[model samples]
Target: MSTFHPFPRLPIELRLRIWSLTAFPRMIHVKRQCVGDHGEFGLQYMATSTPCPPVVQVCQESRRYAPYRRAFTTGAEPRYIWVNFESDMICNDGSHDLLNLEPHQQDIQRLRLPIDDELAYDYITIHGDQEFKKFTNIKEIHIAVDLQFAGFSIEFLAATVNKCFNGFDNKVKFLDVGSGYMMDANQLRILSDWKNYYSFDTHGRANVDTFEGAIRFMRILDNILTLSEMHAIDDENAKIKQDQQFL
Candidate 1:
């Protein structure tokens, strides 16, 4: 492709807008690595899959437009990860300590974590509910289910959700990593109630044990949350219109 010689002559506002448009959401995987003997001083590092945003290195103007910031540092050295907290989703494999991210808790909006025995014990049973409150601005929590532990009871899952992410109006999604199927948390609650009321075996009836079954189950919960959100907006608009008519 030929370079446009007149590109630099464009208005500063237009140039900035173009740079802003280049910003896209990213999924950054973070895990703690044992850098010392006996895993004494573990350090969290970004996986090779996540690369630095190109806009940051393009030009000074583009760097200014990019929202990426250096975060999740160990403080022992200059090592850190470039994070676009507003749009990037941090995928933690239940290795890094959540306390390490407390500095930027309010800025991180999206997070994906594995839900298993380790997570349930650490975050729910051991730390209790207070540890999760650090993320004040969290909007979405993606809980990846570990299919290896097929005996996960609905009570345990619901308790984990309520204890770890309670009091927040964030969207919760459960992802079966083996099948890459995602389900809404509200739908899971409904399923739990239906199972209890009808005396159905939780594992046998849920049908999320197999890949094909998980995909079919996820389809039912896919747009349920989105449709509810649309109805909420319509109700708010109607209320506003009714009040305006009397003015």
Candidate 2:
């Protein structure tokens, strides 16, 4: 056969395995330049022999028509979706390559996001503002936010999260959010409503009483904090210890 095959004799099941890997990571950090008009860097970076463009072309043919065609003749021609870098703070590429398999909406279960405030804010600005109720299969969301830069009002944030997570798919097991004082009252109020969500606190800060009451928040006791900041809070903690001695 003179015609070149994108994947030679590889089992379709194996191909699916590879496809599943591309969908593997729920949290991705792509630099600003990571995405281009040609293709998202993630997809472009997939193991390829020739230049990037040909790789895509070959992959397109290899993937798109194969999976869905075998599944059912009625499906549409496969579209290659990518979670490319749309901006500085977000990884725009997620399941783009898997779409090449011509499957309907994909389902990814775990999301552990390790990002900065800029990206976190950017993510909230893009995806958080709305309810992601459709991603029903999503079971966990871990966000490491830089409270210094992430500008969120408490009530707004709490309400937003409640609206998104309070759905029927309460399978969400853990929510790790490390944010700061930059959050306004509106944001705090919103998060406080999620009193029942599990693993509410991995850090000691959740015990601090805010205007929102004893918040089942996610924070730590500054184990990761810099020495200077720890010293600042240490004085306050010392005063509390002294008061307890009198009692």
Candidate 3:
């Protein structure tokens, strides 16, 4: 009776609830740093606490709460794995991260691919396909691509996607495609063709021909573009203010 343990005295359900809250999932942006001295790549900025979770640091009885462990085990939110395919020799090596996932982490369900013009296809053919084959539990794939930069023919992209998802039959679910660059009539038609071929559930689809659904996509795009412009303007104004302060 020497110790004062108010938290332990609480009901078991309340204690579990408190532990789960401490391990809430946050949006994490992953970037690959250069090859290390051992020539092995390393991840730089994954959004997780430096040490362990506070609850885990508690006594053994608190550690027995499995939900606390499961929640904090994954760096990214469950059901959404993000990969940046932009060609930046400095900070864009997400392809490498996807390739090197541990066996337990390989069973990802949803993927968000953000690709630029250069090296998109090359990266997909080599690294992406390899990862996809390993992702036997993959369910949905979301893409935001710059087709204009790579000058990728519609046929080429379709073939690449098919190849990447070759191993999984119905396990591969919806394809949510959006574009950073403007798409022409022909390009839109190509997406339509792919949708028809896959016959995916459009309830989870975006930027597709379904007029009602497309409206939702357009609204989201508009908000993103607007926010981007606002941020740029804010940065410019801040710079000017700083310069004036110096004067």
Clashes of 2: 21
70-181 per-residue lDDT for model 3 (tens digits):
3212333233222211210111235434344443334444444545454555677677766666655555444445444535544455566566655543333222234224
lDDT of 1 at 105: 68
Candidate 3 has a TM-score of: 0.44
Model 2 weakest lDDT span, ten residues long: 96-105
Q: Order of all candidates by TM-score, from best down to worst?
A: 1, 3, 2
Top-lDDT candidate index: 1
For model 1, give the 10-residue run with minimal summed lDDT: 206-215
Task: lDDT winner between 1 and 3, please give it.
Answer: 1
Give all candidates' CA lDDT scores: 0.64, 0.37, 0.46
Per-candidate TM-scores read 0.73, 0.33, 0.44
Candidate 1 residue lDDT tens string, 1-247? 5866786899988887887677678988765554574347754443325888988887777777766777777544436777888889987654435334536667789987766555444554456467667877888878777656655655566666666666652377777776676656665665455445543465546434443353455456562345467558779999999999999
Which pairs clash in the backbone of model 3?
Answer: none
| lDDT at position 17, candidate 2 | 64
TM-score-better candidate, 1 vs 3: 1
Q: For model 1, which pairs clash?
A: none
lDDT of 2 by residue, 99-128 (tens): 121121124334434334454444554564
The per-candidate count of clashes, in order, stands at 0, 21, 0
